[model samples]
Each structure stands twice: as structure tokens, then as C-alpha cells.
Target: MRGDVMGCSSQSTITNFSPQIAEAYAILRGIRFAMDAGLLPAEVEPDAKTIVYLIIADAPPLAEVGIVISDIIHICKHYNIWVLFTPRCANMVAHNLAKVMPAEDLFYLEEYPPYVESFVLDDKAM
Candidate 1:
């Protein structure tokens, strides 16, 4: 395993989305990305505790957020996964990036934006 970020991604919703929906969708996307990129045995550290708990409980397969939560549950069925809860303040790089990133889909495989770099370094120091 590498002691560095393998990659990161951000995507626009194309239209307005509620905070909870956006967070669930982003987590779903991140899980799919890791699966697709051959990054097995993944662990997700989410700042949203409720979402994490729902996913951990394997939320129902029906409803809106439940649909996305169900998908995450389904994926871990065949793979190793760990869901860890992290506070927003402890993940400042992610919090800051979400605030300033553009309204478009973007992916960075190791390379990060200049503005994001400092926060990342600060994170490493911790």
C-alpha cells in the first residue's frame, strides 16, 4: 500500500442538489472510482456521520438516499471495505477543495492544484 493519495476526483451535479444528496453521491462516486482503478480493499473516511452510519447499517434499497446507500452496501459485498467517520475540521483539504473547486468534473492522479497543495502538506504534517 502507498502512504500517499492515489488520486482524487470532484464532479458537478449539473443542477442544484441538497447537501445530503451531494455527500452521498460523492461518496458513491469515490467508491466506484477506487473499484474501477483497481484500488482494492478500500476504506472511506467521511465527514458526514449520519451518511456513514446509514451505509454501515446497510440502508434500505428503496428511497432516494437509500438507493445510493444500497449501492455502496452492494459493492462491499464482494470486496473489503472500511467506513471511518472523520470530522470536517480533521479533513480540511477535502473541506476546502469542495468549497473552491469549479463546477465541472475533474480528476487528479497524484497531481493536485496549487491552492490545494498547501492544505495537503499541512495534512501530511499532522
Candidate 2:
């Protein structure tokens, strides 16, 4: 399963849980909701071959995330979704955007500040 870090804006998507894994799952749910609403790439159809782009950060308890990741893997496996791990640097675009916005106004791209594009485009792997 994919795993990654998000900026503070994604904090809302996380459930108010003490464990990192639980918090991380909340973000995953938010992402799934966005996909349902057509925010992410349409190529990742749920019924067809699905792909999850998990953004990961370098931090402690990577092993814990690995355990939680197994759960994600199981669910994705049931749905035929492919999980991809992306570095935090690559995911910084979303994280940076999340940092400056009001919670109510976080997810919309049209409302994002101009600087976020630099982070988004900076990922050479793309």
C-alpha cells in the first residue's frame, strides 16, 4: 500500500486519533473521497485497475506505518487498487498548500497560493 506525509491542511481529513496510523487512515479516507468526487486522476477508476498515490515522509515508526500499510494493502487488494509509495518531497506540493489555508477552504486548487506550483513542479520524478 502507498504511504506519505501531508501538510497541515490534510490534518482535517485525519480523524482525531492519538495514533499516527489512525490519523494517516483519515487522510487516506479524505483522498478516497476526493477521488470519488473526481479530484484526483480519472485514470484511476475504482472498478478498473485502481492506483493509490501514497506520499511518505521520513520519520520515526516507519515500521508502524508498515503495519498499517498492510491493512491498506488488504483493502486495496480486494478492490484491485495498486498502491504506490511517493516521497515526502514529491508530496510537498499538497503539504505546503495545506499549511497556509483555512480548514474550510483547504482542498480547492483554485484557491491555493501561487507558490504551491513551484513545489508541485519541482518533483523531477514526474
Candidate 3:
């Protein structure tokens, strides 16, 4: 995306939210946002390998977060989306955003949050 963030969202979840569910939700949100913005033929790079495998295989949701994965699959039916799994170390932006954003509110922005600037810079240099 030319070093320009299309949009970033910090989706805070319940105290008991499963990590898998949270990851799936994040991917789901990203897809929906891109679709709404008319950004088709997207490629998603998620750090969760399980979710990526499930989505790619279009597998039935057997896990607790299957519902979210199902939704992601449904949405992909309307457009071309390639889901790839990235190692956490290479996904610094998402990793830092999860650590820094307040759990009480959802954050959406076109620019990297101040807290995430350092990581973004590091990523760009990679």
C-alpha cells in the first residue's frame, strides 16, 4: 500500500476473548473495511497460522472461533482475497497495536498511532 496505511483498527475484545477469536475478528474487520471502501482483490497477511489455514482451505469451523472464520470466508466469496500467514516478528504493527491500544475503545485511523510509529518505521526499513 505504498507505506500508507489503508486503515488500522484496534478492536478491543472481552476479557475472556480467545486469542484465536481475536485474530479471526481482526481479519474479518480488515476484510469488511476494505470491501466497504471498494478495495477489492485484497491480500491479507495475518500472523495467526491456524486462521490462515482454515480460511485458505475454506474449512468448516470446528474451533471456537469458527464463526468468525466462517464470516471471513463468506465475505471473500464476493471478492478476490488471498490470505497469507506472517510470522509475528514480521508483523510488528499488529503486535504493537495490540499491546498499546486501550482495551476499552476501538481505534480506527489512516495514520499509524503514535505508539506504533517506531514499529512502523522498523517495518518499512525491513
Candidate 4:
């Protein structure tokens, strides 16, 4: 969590899944981005404990999010990644970033967005 922000992305999808599913999708997308950028030995700290447990336990996910969990598991298998459960407060930067990002697009930030800058700074100061 102390590393520099390498990149960020947003994906807007039309689906009837719950917010948890959407979060899982976003986490998977981030992992893929990091892998593509050759950022291995990654540690993915997600605010969703269920998703983190599923990945850590290597158990089958519920039907609604099975596909996403599968993809995440596949990526983790190919890289040195650890999916840890992070509290929302500790994950404020990502939470705020998700709020301010455009829909359906992957954005690479050279700098933090204005709205999330404070959150980033707060995390850094911790």
C-alpha cells in the first residue's frame, strides 16, 4: 500500500449484479492492468472481504460472481499476488477514485485526480 500509484482504471458495465460483483470486476480489472504492465509480485488489497476470502481460500465463488472470481484466481496463479482484505477507511483512495472516474473507460493517471488527491495524501501520511 506504500508504493507509488502506477495506474488506475474504471469500467462501466451494464449488468444486474450487486455492488459486490461490480467491485470484484473492478479488482480483477486492476490485476489485469498490473500484469499487462509487468508489475508482478503484486499485493491486491480489496475492501471486499468475501472476495478476498474466496481468492485466498481458493474456493468456488457464488454463481453470480463465479466468472470474475475465476479470472482473478487465474491471474493470481500466474503471478506473485496476495489478495488481502483492506478496510474501507484504509482504501479511501481507491474508493474515491472509483467515484470520480468516467464510466466504461480505463484511465491511466499520470497524477492523482483532484477529488482523490487528499485521500491519497492521507493514506501516504499514515
Model 2: per-residue Cα lDDT at residue 32: 60
Tens digit per residue, CA lDDT, model 4, 5-111: 76666656666778878878888888987777767788888788888888888875668787788888888887887789999898787887677546556666445
Best by TM-score: 4
Q: How does each model score on lDDT? A: 0.75, 0.43, 0.77, 0.77
Candidate 3 lDDT, 1-126, residue by residue in tens: 544566676666555668888788889888887776666787778888988999999984877798998889888877897778988888788787767546565545567678778878788777
RMSD of 3: 2.2
How does each model score on TM-score? 0.85, 0.45, 0.82, 0.86
| TM-score, predicted candidate 1 vs. hidden true structure | 0.85
Would you give me the overall lDDT of model 3? 0.77
| Location of the lowest summed lDDT over 10 successive residues in candidate 3 | 100-109
lDDT of 1 by residue, 15-115 (tens): 57667778888888888877777777888777988888888877654667787778778887777877777888777767776777576777777666677
Q: Total clashes, candidate 3?
A: 0
Model 1: clashing residue pairs?
A: none
lDDT of 2 by residue, 1-126 (tens): 122122223334434544556535644555464454544431121211112323222222445545555555554545544444444565666556545534653444223356665664564345
Q: Candidate 2: give the clashing pairs.
A: 4-55, 4-56, 5-55, 7-95
